[model samples]
Target chain A: MNAQFRRRIASAALIIGFFVAWELLCLAFNVKDIVLPRPSQIIVTLIERIPAIWPHAVQTLYTTLVGFALGIAFGVLIGVVIGSSRLAYDVAYPLLVGFSSIPKVAVVPIFVLWFGAGTVPAVLTAMILCIFPIVVNVATGLATTEPELEDVMRALKASKLDILLNVGLPRTMPYFFASLKVAVTQAFVGTVIAETVASNRGIGNLMMIASSSFDVPLVFAGLLILAALGVALYVIFSFIEMRVTGWARRKDEFALG
Target chain B: MLAPPSAPPHAETYVALERVTHTYGRDDRQVKALDETNLKIDKGDFIALVGPSGCGKSTILKLVTGLLTASSGYVFVAGREVGAEPVRVGIAFQNPTLLPWLTLRDNVMLPLKIVPPFRQEYHAKRRTEFRDRVDALLDQVGLGGFGSKYPWQLSGGMMQRASLCRALVHEPQLLMLDEPFGALDQFTREELWAIMQELWIAHRPTVLLVTHDLKEAAYLANRICVMQARPGRIIDDTIVLFPRPRTIAISFDPRFVALTQRLRELIVVASPPKDSNP
Candidate 1:
């Protein structure tokens, strides 16, 4: 078998072995359901509650996706504005750093007060949490263009915008893709936190409702489902990163374009 | 390849620096990098400026390319005053600085897509023709099949070769080299020196190469100018007078060794004495 195939199978085996050991240990220790449930019990509950759980999972996915889009659009827009101009970078960067330092969870109540307890608060929370990294990464990528390359461009009589278009934007792709991967995962976390505090729709709300009734197995299942969704979104972004920014990537990272 | 409209039909002085002095910082902390340096190159002349580090060899190159303005001198290139607007000039540095995201072909074609007269029609009916030109230039530099490869896929020497192609692709009337082959291995540097000479011979862009290597200066340039230490200015000018198609064998000739030895001794003499605080 190829090395990649062998590595994949070995990793899969380790994950499966971990769960098997966890299940056996749970029974051997006679662990209580409220504290921790066996993996098998969680799996059975997930299958039985699939129909009821699917809608909440879909709602969480929708909110996170919508908020993620908002973060990327505005984050990149603001990032480019700040990155391309020295004045904007100097003025906006400090303000952004100060703003990102404030916890998004602390601002959830404010968003709820403005938009009410629903998807709006959840989406806004996700956007607020995820936008910082995107802005910082994009701005850094655009700002750190090799000065020597800039010299070459200037010698050719290229204007600033011309240099930015031909070199700056393409150079930012790897950083941009890396930011997307991190931001997508952070978006899910933001959505869940908002739903736990202010919303009534997502898998976060479902977990809250289930735990309140002491349905411990169902709560674990909801968490597992959210994790799966997060992983799925991250994989999608990674796949697109490989396709679009292949030239910027190392061979071990993916492969040269 | 369209020539820059500014080029004069009967220009004698392609690049000239008249009493150029450049100061780096402001006020008391200011450092004079180049002090009243003067140089003039006729059309299609190839010259090398040899000096120790921080001797302002690079400052002169930057002045001619309009990367930095002279503190108090009249700099001219292609018959226009420097610092007015950027003129058509090609430059290569020690680092290839090829964009990692671009294929070698795309990297070479970059200047064409940016500079004026050619940029006006880069993507219209001239796209295929431009591609062919880039291919031809790459082939000329021993990088024929490597055009589709990205920068990382190529060795450092290959990358530098591509860089030379990129600098020349726009067909600028003047080419500047700031230690273009200094970072490569010894063998690769010698090989690239030959390639550079061939390129210069084929398309004689008025050239100015700034380097620390005396042998490199002797082997490539028609005239070698040695500079003094800090606040650099040329102290000696020696004409090589070597016949064309000059090969590596010339370095072993008695006259070649003597010339390189003399230039080396001059550099040592020009080096500043160390501080004697004891």
Candidate 2:
């Protein structure tokens, strides 16, 4: 426990040092606030714009969460189906790859036209951007199950569903969680981009308004909030991943032990 | 020294392979894995297959376990054809192959969770009883306190022991081993051989082991079937007269040495000469 405390303190010090260096660099250069606002100035703007920024933050969060959930649901469902069936994989793989290759941001206007402004377009855009990683990761996990283990299941007369439930699903959970970590962050970015183009609400819109008004410090504050939110969401998902893969954690502990 | 026991009366054949042949690939690029092989294993018999690489020894084991069907021939388990019927056959490989995401207890219970009669009652009332059974098997294999651990946490030997417990947890009638101890160091391998011998004596499951080690074959098997190289055919079917319960000390015995030498000679004779080496 003492060692862990020391490590935490060390990490906090490192983070503080990084921010201090950034502030010092800006001060030493005597850079303009519009180019790179000092940490102190950014904090002041954050405090002043709290009322304006909070609602937009909430809007972005809503769209991001909804899009992320939908992406995971559809991605895992399609991934499992395609992964489990060779025929499905053959049919769907090229199409998924082709769709994924198209620039997601370029389709934002089309999504805006379809869903109109506000949360729906933003959420749909986020979903389109986030689903691919989950599908690819989950599909690979399900498909690469050990042949020897499969034989064991067959020898035991396990049905296809039994194999999927008992072996396939549990095995794929780690991969799914890993992809979720990536997808959630992508969802945040996607929501922000969608809002920048189409929505009147959200942090992206707030940043855009600040930029046009030349409120550089407020723009920096909005960017900081988005970064903080992304990191927080990522940390939350990582915690959930650790819980879901408890068996793997125990195994790792044993190996280290 | 104790005298060897006589063979039990009224031994019944448990597995019979009649003129089994397996050919891989198609007409122009074909390779015969097993060539018209015929063998019978009586109940409680411990048989080992030894040969050079690509000798179809592992192929035979796969065929008996119904993992791979013979191209032309019939495999019978317990006097019934094993084509469509699922027989009670346990298997262990060179790698432990325990699922890394499951606890040792869960891994051992996997077959039970999948296999019927146990699967039906597994979720409700039998949880405690099932756990106890898993505990017993783990105890038998010297892994009593490690049930909550995962595969990656264990050493190679421990993982292999867990795998052995998993294979036998359901009390399978036949155990198929494909070079199960091939990856271990010398001492661990010999130690496992003793453990395996004890397990076989206690359980009396009909075992078919495929190995490249002549000494392993001589130590454990009632019969050692040596196979020739690719498009592999059985070259020798010699019965081991060595007494059991065999120990690592037996490997140093003069008779064991002579038997190993003979098997080595057969393998040397059976192998095709290399053109580029000399």
Candidate 3:
């Protein structure tokens, strides 16, 4: 097999082996479900209760996606402003850094206080949590445009806007997509944080309710569902990133061991 | 088919630098890159500037292209002073600088889509026409079939050839090259020199080439100017009387060797003392 296919098979085997070990270890030690539910038990619960849990899954996904989209829009706008001007970079970047360093969960309650503890609070939390990385990556991408290329554009008599659109944006795609992968995971964290604290819906709320009632398997099932959704979104974004910025990436090459 | 002549012969000088001075950095760190440098080129002339590394060969190009304003005096192109707004010029550098994301065709066609007169109607009606122009230039540079490839897919020589096509695709009145072939291997450089000669004969832009290679200056340029470092200014100007479509074999000719030798001697004289430490 080719190295890529072989590598993929190895990865799959590792994941399946981990779960198998988890199942065997739990059964051998007679582990209590309250402390750590078996993977098999979680899977069974996930399949059996999927119908009841479907709505919460949908709610969490929708909120995270909306917040992530808004985060990207605002992040790119701010990034462009800061990246294109040295004064703005010097002035605004420090404030942005300070804002980002504040633990997002701490701000979730503030969002709750203003927006009344529902989808709005969850979305705002998700957006604020994810904006920092995207802003930083986009600004870096814009800032790193090659001086030689800039000379080419300048000699063409291109305006600043033209250079940004034709050169800067294309050059920024790989960085932007990289930020998206990281930002998407952060968005999920933001949504779940707000959801568990205040919302009556979503996987986070369902998990909280299940735990309080001692439905340990159900809580594990919720965690599994969140992980699956996260992986799916990551995969989707990775695929799109590959399509949009293929030129920037090197083709895979075989290496000798 | 080649496009019609972009410039009709005119009595007025097409490019003129009148006592232009350019200083880099500010205050204590300031260094004069070019000092009261004066040059003039008639329409469709090929000129070469040869000097040591710090002699401001590139500074002169930046001024003519309007990328930088002269610290003092006037820089003129196409009968207008160059400042604030850049004058139309096609430029290439030591690096190919092709956008990795763009296909060779798209990279070459970039100028048409950006420069004003063509950009105003680039997509409306002239895309295919512009594509044809790009293809023709690529063909001239021996990169015709490779137009669909990305810059990274090509060899360094091919990329530099594409860069040349991009510079000329817009048919700017002036063509500025700053050590464009400096990075190529000897064989590749010689091959490109022949190709460059063909392109100039076909397009006839008022070409200004900057190089350290005295042979390159003698082979391609009809007029060669040698500059001195430290408050850089031209010290000698010589007109080459070689016939059109000069071949690579001409480098062996006694006259060509003498010309290059003369330019070499001038550069060595102008070079700063070897022992002087900054």
- The DockQ leader among the candidates is 1
lDDT of 2: 0.86
| Candidate 3 per-residue lDDT over residues A69-156, each given as its tens digit | 9999999999988877667777888898898899989998898889897999999999998899999999889888887888899888
**Candidate 1 per-residue C-alpha lDDT over B27-105 given as tens digits, one digit per residue, 9 for 90 to 100:** 9998888899888887888899997777899999998988898889899877779756456689999999998877788
- In model 2, the runs with Cα more than 4 Å from the true position are A1-14, A21-36, A85-91, A246-257, B1-10, B275-278
What is the Cα-based lDDT of residue A236 in candidate 3?
96
Residue-by-residue lDDT tens digits, candidate 1, A37-138:
998889999999999999999999999999999999999998888888778888888899999899778999999999999999999999998899999988
Question: What does the lDDT read for residue A5 in candidate 3?
Answer: 100
Task: Sort by TM-score, best first.
Answer: 3, 1, 2
Write down the C-alpha DockQ for each prediction: 0.73, 0.48, 0.60
lDDT of 1: 0.87
Worst 10 residues of 1 chain A by lDDT: A248-257
After superposing candidate 1, which stretches have Cα over 4 Å from the reference? A1-7, A85-93, A252-257, B1-11, B83-86, B125-127, B275-278
TM-score of 1: 0.92
